[model samples]
Target: MDTTLEELYTQYPDTVKKNRKKHIVIKSEADVACPQIEANTRTIPGIISQRGCAYAGCKGVVVAPIKDMITITHGPVGCGYYSWGTRRNKARADSTTPKDKIYSQLCFTTDMQEPDIVFGGDKKLARMIDEIVAAFHPRGINICSTCPIGLIGDDIGAVAKAATERHGIQVLAYACEGYKGVSQSAGHHIANNTIMQNVIGKGNERKPGKHVINVLGEYNIGGDGWEQERILKDCGYTVNCVMTGDASYEDIKNLHLADLNLVQCHRSINYIAEMMETKYGTPWLKVNFVGVEATNESLRQMAKCFSDPELEKQTEEVIARETARIEPALEQFRKICRGKKAFAFVGGSRSHHYQHLLKDLGMEVVVAGYEFAHRDDYEGRQVIPTIKSDADSKNIPELHLKADEKLYREGNEYLNLSKEQFEALKKEVPLNYYEGMYPDMKNGDIMIDDCNHYELEELIKKLRPDLIFTGVRDKYIAEKMGIPAKQMHSYDYAGPYAGYNGAINFANDVAHTLTTPAWKMIVPPWERIEEPDTGKQEGAN
Candidate 1:
C-alpha cells in the first residue's frame, strides 16, 4: 500500500505542518470543492530549497540569453564565473546587425575586490563597461547587480547611464540581487520590468508582414526557440523576435510592432505582455509548444485571433502534415510508456507545460509542483484580483505603462474585429488571460508549491513513480532512490524539444529513461540491512 500524504504531514512539527499542509493538496476525485494551494511565500528557515536565487533568475535565466548584449555581472567574479554556461541558452549571430556577434558565448564581470565592496563597486563597474566597449563593440551592455553589490549600496544605474553617454551604446542596469525577494520569482519580475522600461518599443526599424508575432518568454534553452520558430514560419507567421533567447538587442526593441504576441512562458515575461497591450494595443495569446497536441492548439488559437481564412487554412495543413509524421514514433514509445507514472517539479511553467508532452506518450504525471510559482499559476488568473501582496512581493516595483503617443496601435488596426466578434473569439481562445494549471490536472493529482527536500523524498516513497522530471538540485537524489530522473530545466543535455520533431525527441528521451537498466542497480541506504560496525559489503560480486 502507498503511503498517504496525511501521514507525511505528521513528520513536521505542529506549526510547521500546519503551514506545509496548505501548500499541498491531494485533489479529491468525487468532491465538489476545489483544492487551493498557498504559493509565493518564503521557504522554511532551515530547509534547503531547490529554488534558484533572484540573481540566477535575472541574469542566468532572463537577460543573459540576449546574444547581442554584453551582460556584465556587477559584483564579485565568482557570481559571474559559476553561473556562466550553466544554462544551455543558445543563439546565432546575425551579420545584419552592427557587431554581428553573439556575446552570450562569453562571461563579463566587474570583478569587484575587497576594497570595492567596502567603499563602493560602482566605479569598478563603470570601468568594466568601458573595457567591454573598447574590446568588443557590442550592441548593448546590461549590468546585473548581485547580492554583494546590493548590500554595499552600489549605484549600478548611475554607472550604466554614464557608460551609455560615454560609449554611445545602450547600457541598462538590473538590481536583481539574490536577497531581493522570497525566490527567483522576484528576479523574473525585476528583469521583466527593466526590459519594459528601457528596451521594448525603442526600435527604429520595422519589417513588412501581415502575420507578425513576438514570441515572448522563450529563452531558447537547448534551441527550443529554433524548432518553435520553424513551425510558426511553416504556418506563414513572421516571428518578430523570440524574447531574450537567440534574440538580439535590436530585434527585441521592435516588440511593439508585432500584430500579436505568442506568450510561451507566462511567469517570466507576462509583465511585458500586459504592459505592451496597454501601450500598443497588441493582444497576447498564451501558448504552450512543449507538446505536440498543445502546440497544435496554440497554433490554432493564433489562427483564431488573426481571423484570416487563408492563414488558418495554411496552419491546418502544417498541423496535419507534422502530426502525421510524428504519430508513428509516438505510438512506438506509447507501447513502452503506457500506464507509466511520472513526477514533475520544475522551475515555473515547464512543470505544467511538460505534463502535456508526457500525456502524449501515454504516460501520466501523477505528481507535480513548481519551485517558484504564485497562486495565480496554480489557480487561474481569476485569482490574481483576489490575491493580496505580501512584504516579499512588495519589494519589487511595478511598471505604470501608458499608451505610446506615436507608436500606440488602436484596437481595430490589426485585429480587424467588431466589438461583438472580438468578445466571441476570446471565449474560445485565451486572448489576454491564462486559466492556470488546475483545470488541466486530474482530480486526484497532487500540487505542491515551493517543495522542499523532505516533501520530495516522501513523494518519491509514496508515489513510486517510474520517472522524475526535475532540476539538477534534486535529480541525483531521486536517481539514487532507484528512479529514473530527467533534468527538465536544461533537458539533461538534449533538446530542440518544443515542436513537431521536438515531440518525438521528448518521447524518445522518456522511452530511454524508463527502460534504462542502470536505475535498478541503485541500492538505497534505507533498503540495506542493519549490518552494524563493518565497512564491508554483504553481497559482494
Candidate 2:
C-alpha cells in the first residue's frame, strides 16, 4: 500500500513536521481553490536544497547567455569561475564575424580581494572594466555582483556609469546579491530590470517583417532556441529576437520594434514581457514549446494573434508536417512507456513543462515540485496581487514604469476587435491566460514547494517511481537507488528539446533511459533466488 502524506509527516520532529507539512500537499478534489503550498520561502537550515543563489540567477541564468557581451562577475574568483560554462546555454558565432561581436567563450571577473572588500571595490571595478574594454573592445559589458560586494556595500552602479562614459559602450551593473531572496527567482527579476533600464529600446531600427515577435525567457540550452526559431521562421513569422539564447546585443536593443512577445518560461522572464508591453505596446502571450502538443498550441496561438489567414495556414501546414514525421516513433515509445510512474523536481517552469512530455509518453507523474519558484508559478499569475510581500521579497526592487508616448500604440489593429470578435479569436487562440500547475495536475498527485534531498529520498523510497526528472545533482542519487533519472535543466547535455524534433528526441531518451540493461543489474541475481525449505530447517534448529 502507498504511504499517505499525513503518515510521512509523523516521522519528523514537531516543529519540522509543522513547517514541512505546509510545503508538501496532496491535491484533493473537494478543494475548489488552488492548493496552497508554502513557496519562495527560505530553506530550513540543515536541509540540502537544490536551489541556486540570487547571483547565480542573475549572472548564470540571464546575463551570461548574451553572446556578444562580456559578463564580468564583480566579486570573488570562485563565483565567476564556477558559473563559467556551467549551464550549456549554447551560442553559435562564426569565426568570420568581427571580434567585437563574439565574447561568449570568455569568463571575465573583477577578482575582488580581502583588502578591496574591507574598503570598497569601486576603484578596482572601474579599472577592471577599462582593462576589459581596451583588451577585448567588446560591444558591451555586464557586471554582476556576488555576496561579498552586497555585504560590503560596493558602489557597482557608480563604477558602471563611469566605465560606460569612458569606454563609449553599454555598461550595466546588477545588485543581485546571493542573500537577497530565498532563491534565483530574485536574481531573474534583477536581471530583467537592469536589461530594461539599459539594453532595451536604445535603437529605433525595425527589422522588416509581416509578423514580428520576440521569443522571451528562452536560454537556448542545448540548441533549444535554434529549434524554436526554425519553427517560427518556417511558419512565415519573423523571430525579431530571442531574449538571451544565442542573442546579440544589437538584436536585443531593438526589441521595442517587435509587434508581439511569446513568453516560454514565464517564471524567469515574465517581468521583461510585462515591462515591454507597458512600454512599447507590444502584446505578450505565454507559450510552451517543450512538448509536441504544447508546440502545436503555441504556434496556433501565435497565428491567431496576428489574425492573418495566410499565416494560420502556414502554421497548420508546419504542424501537420512535423506531427506526421514523428507520430510513428512517438507511438512506439508510448506503447512501451505506458503505465510507468515518474517524478520531477526541477527548476521553475520545468517541473510543469516536462509534465506535458511525460503525459504524451503515456507516463503518470506521481510527484513534482520546484526549487526556486514562487506561489505564482504554482497557482498562476492571477494570485500575484494577493501574495503578501515578506522581508525577503521586499528587498527586491519593483521598478515603476510608464508607456513611451511616442512608441505606445494604444488599441492597435490586432487588439482593436470588438468583444464578440475577441471572444471568437480566443476560441482559436488563448490570450493573457494561464491556469497554473496545480489545476493541470491530477487530484491525488503530490505537489511540493522547495523540495530538498531528504524529502526526495524519502519520496523515492515510498513511490518507487520508474523514472525521475531533475537536475544533475539528483541524477546519480536516483540512479543509485535503481531508478533512471534524466536531467531536465541542461537536458543532461543532450537536447534541442523545445520543438517538433525535440519532442521525439525526448520520448526516445526517456524510453532508452528506463529500458537500459544497466538498471537491471542493480540487484544481484542471487538476491532474486529462492532458498526453498533450507530457511525453515535453520529456524527449527
User: For residues 1-541, what per-residue lDDT tens digits would candidate 2 score against the true structure?
Assistant: 2266666778788988888888877877888877777898888888888999999999999999999899999999999999888788988763323555788777988898889999898899898888888888888899999999988999888888888899899899999888878999999999999999888998777778778888999999999999999999999988878878888888889898887888888889988988887787677788999888888988988887767789999999999999999999999999878899999998999889888878878888889999988888888888988888899988888888899888787424435555577678667665655667887688888899888777887788777899999988987778877788999988876888889889888888888998898988795233466656654566465
Per-candidate RMSD vs. true structure? Answer: 2.5, 4.8
Residue 380, model 1, lDDT: 70
Which pairs of residues clash in candidate 1, taking residues 3 or more apart in a chain or in different chains?
none
Tens-digit lDDT track of model 1 for 122-232: 877887788888988888999898999889898888888899999998999899999998888899999999989888878876667678888999989899999999999
**Ten-residue stretch with the least lDDT total in model 1:** 93-102
Model 1 CA deviation exceeding 4 Å by range? 1-3, 29-34, 98-100, 534-541
Model 1, position 395, has a per-residue lDDT of 95
Residue 75, model 2: lDDT of 94
